[model samples]
Target: MVKKVIRIILLNIFSLFPLDSRKIIFESNSEIKDNSKALFLKILDLGVNSKYKIIWPVENPKECKDAFKEYKNVSFVKKSKSGSSSLLFLYHCCTAKYCFYTHNPLGQRTREGQRKVFLTHGTPIKDTRGMFWPPYENTDIISTSEFAAYLRCKTFGGGDDVVRLLGFPRNDFLFKTDKGTEEYFDKIKKSKFIIWLPTFKRHNISVKRRDFDEDKNSDISILSPGFMEKLNNYLKAKDILLLIKYHPSQNLDYVSLKSYSNIITLTNDQLEKNNVDLYSLMGKSDALITDFSSVYIDYLLVNKPIGFELGDYKSYKNGRGFIVDNPLDFMPGEKIKSPGDLYTFIDNIFSGVDKYEEERIKLRNKMHKYVDGDSSERVLRYFELIN
Candidate 1:
């Protein structure tokens, strides 16, 4: 209660000062990543921030600053915690004329004259708590497709005023082909690249969500040592490199990840340290392997092979239900249930045989109204910020 009051007072106090029309603040869950970072970089790419002040309030100012130190217009401030916007953070948030954020880390709205746009982290597939209810209501939310926009309003529980169907800015990175991205691609040891992204499953353990399972769910550790080695041998022989990017919420220790011949694990810290743009890397990858992660939804733009390793499908559905009734209906890709299935998926990719190509295209058309990689432009044009 005290924290809430303090934040409210600070926001109102900060609102008294005139908002800076040329100032733009970007924020996320205090981590210098996600759609917020994507849009921030997009603004810089336009070569329009020469006179504009760009600020990002983060938990680690030094880390965030270093991530984009090449840009002169960028600055980082300590993020607000509990309710204290660290004074400096509050000042920037209140004064900025435009703000782009994924998570509402500020926790308070100082939108007296400021425009707030919420670039939600990702599309909601499971009944995740933070994805729905509150904060999202009445905020300008970015979505890729009309179906996604509808899903956002339904899951996020916001009115028509909340949605902007101009597509996600990060997906634009996937469409890019630059020398920088090419260099990153060249760093890979194998000729072929594939990425696997697993969704966070916090609620799968005797959790609480309406209609979700209360009992503990089955464990889904599909990466046994034997399985990893076997998969690694196949990847080595096939000249395919597999990159597994774990969710921040999911602990890597549990996986007992080992150094494999043709497999590598990527973490948020590793990506940040290298200043690598994730979606840019994804754009160049050959194929994708994911389980209930919204990253797969965005990968639809790549129009490549995708495989869903739903080892614990039943438990996951019963423990943490999907937003859509028939999740498989939306999944237009190979289904991997065992080692044999996974190997087959990889083999098909190597052979340039896509079984679900038609289904993927159909679903892609159904989900994405715009297939072109100009979503970032759409967003800027919608706001009249660009010609």
Candidate 2:
């Protein structure tokens, strides 16, 4: 009883501050740029006709601030030092009639507000838990997959009416020939491209740094010298160019590996270089290797081999979390559990039997049905648009 009271008091204390305060005070320093801003910019472009103003309140709003450059009405309001990020959302729920969001576990009051439509921001993994999309007593959930919707219902105890299985808006380019695929395919047809998109799991170093710091490295050993060595070796061994996509907050000194002609680092700004959308990178890659990133689920659309690095799966589940029906069911090519296992898996991808294409396509079809390049249109229409 005392603990519950303390929690309530803490919540009230947090609610008193500005949104930027909570985020700026807690977010890690390794942030390269706000990728979510880039994503929301895409959203603004698609929804330019809509009058419902889009508000993005992030700690580092510099990169995302420009996402609204094309649109006049889109607003970027940085929360004052006293406001909390979660509380800011809660406050906005009362005022903003409609809000589109990505990640916010504390988003409960949206049910009472006009509407809060969510875009699945990051790739989900197998073992993720209640944090991704919390099962609130009352709230509408916009999910990226039927699997995700089902998981929210089954795992977190959310009801059927609360879950909306809309496909991810970001992947619209993957299905659209003009938006991303034509350009992406043009690149892949020339050379082998391996996109190393690992999860933010401490084991994989994909989880937000703030969350990991709270635990103080008790479970996962994030980014050891040995791990860096393995990655360097991977860079050297193959002609395949690696597209290293880190989490928004992760800061891998990709410059250290840039000496190798086969390695390249992908930043949010770099998206403009080849007009590459992230999903297109996945679609055009020769093979997809990830720790727990759900991007594999999307990459499966290309019918390529999907590899899993579970070197610290046990530790990650204990520390961060996972998001799938069965953790192992989603891993396609090989379930690697150690440094040596990762090496072997890479060897097999380059030299072994390439037999994961069929399963990859089958799963991609089952998991993703609405990859018709109309996801953005559908999302905009759901909010009431002409096209």
**Tens digits of per-residue lDDT for model 2, 1-387:** 875665455555544443321121101111212223334445556565254455556555655457446675554444433334444444543355444555543332423434544444544554345444445533555565676567545645555676666566656555544455476556544246677776543323443443332343322243354565566567566655666665543444421223235555565546655656676556566777777766776666556677786666665566555555377766668776666766666676667457666666666666776655555556556655434
Residues 239-274, candidate 1, lDDT per residue (tens digit)? 999988777765455554466878988777776556
Candidate 1: clashing pairs of residues: none
Q: For each candidate, what TM-score against the reference?
A: 0.90, 0.68
lDDT of 2: 0.53
**Winning candidate number (lDDT):** 1
For this target, which candidate reaches the highest TM-score against the unseen true structure? 1
lDDT of each: 0.75, 0.53
How many clashing residue pairs, candidate 2?
17
